[model samples]
Target: MDWFYGPMVQMHALLAWCSVGLFLVRGLGHQFGGAWVMDERLRTLVFSSHLLIVISGISLWGALHHDPLYEPWMTAKFIALGVYFAVGHWALGRGEFRVIGYLLALLALGYVAAVSVTRQVLLGL
Candidate 1:
């Protein structure tokens, strides 16, 4: 059971990193070259990564259910992720609002990374 759980945890970590990577690349592409880059493709990739990130995150949370620190950070992270998803989807329409949505997504990603590392919510701590 321990061996199985360990590998599952590792897989979750890998997926989380991949999600962050995809989000970073997609966000940077839009920021740096929205005019030249294929906005639709990058947008699609970002949306896909968001789904992957959420799934991997949930798996990781399930694996760490016994840990005392897991619940709080996981809840906070999900709320942040939800806001990010909403912003991204909303921005798909209005051209001017897209930049704001991208910025919010970046902030949400930053929050995810920080919570993942520290395993503590700043507001809570």
Candidate 2:
């Protein structure tokens, strides 16, 4: 299990970054009128990557024996993750709200990243 921790962390981090990168590409492409952005294969890849990210995150949490209920930073990250999902849904959907939703999703992601690094619910404060 100890050896699993290191690899799990790496995998989770990689998947997280990959997920964000895919979202950025799709979001930008869709915004810029790239028809390929709506391709089923690309959407499938994005979905698969996100699924892997969640799986790896849960594995890491279990390996670390983390209790999110008692960990403020973990709790904060969970909340931000929810916000990311909600806003991300709208961001990727068809509507004039897409741009605003995309920006909000990025902000939520930033908050999650900051909390993960600093382990602070209030970030710099």
Candidate 3:
């Protein structure tokens, strides 16, 4: 792989880990009877991180297109990211939908964890 691809993948990997951390903080804040963790700055950070993660992840997937088992995780990551972003948007919006958004965020975290473990998502698809 070229230097750019390696670093790009590395950045995505790092962002994935950072997202996990952010999700955890958000979850803990909610679970422990605190405020929403993705308030303003954290929300912006999460948004940027998520966007970059997706972009970098896609680039990494393209770089590994020749490989057989390189797509499953990418597809799953995309779906997971979609949910995460949607839920986060709603959660930060206001009103009764906030709780549902929080729940979705938790599910999003679970999906992220799955992606991390599986490392291959779009198999045969």
Q: Best by lDDT, which number?
A: 2
**Candidate 2, residue 81: how far the Cα is off, in Å:** 0.9
Q: Considering lDDT, which of the candidate structures 1 and 2 is the better prediction for this target?
A: 2
TM-score of each: 0.66, 0.93, 0.63
Please report how far candidate 1 places residue 124 from its true position, in Å: 8.6
Compute the lDDT for candidate 1: 0.67
List the candidates ranked by TM-score, beginning with the highest: 2, 1, 3
lDDT for 87 (candidate 3) = 84
User: How many angstroms is residue 23 displaced in model 2 relative to the true structure, after the best TM-score fit?
Assistant: 0.8
Q: Write down the lDDT that model 3 would get.
A: 0.71
Model 3 segments more than 4 A misplaced = 2-7, 26-43, 66-73, 120-125
Highest TM-score: give the candidate number. Answer: 2
Q: Residue 125 in candidate 2 has what lDDT? A: 98
In the order shown, what is each candidate's alpha-carbon RMSD? 3.8, 1.2, 4.5
Query: Tens-digit lDDT track for model 2 on 12-87?
Result: 8888888888888888877777889879999899889888988988888887889988898999999999999999
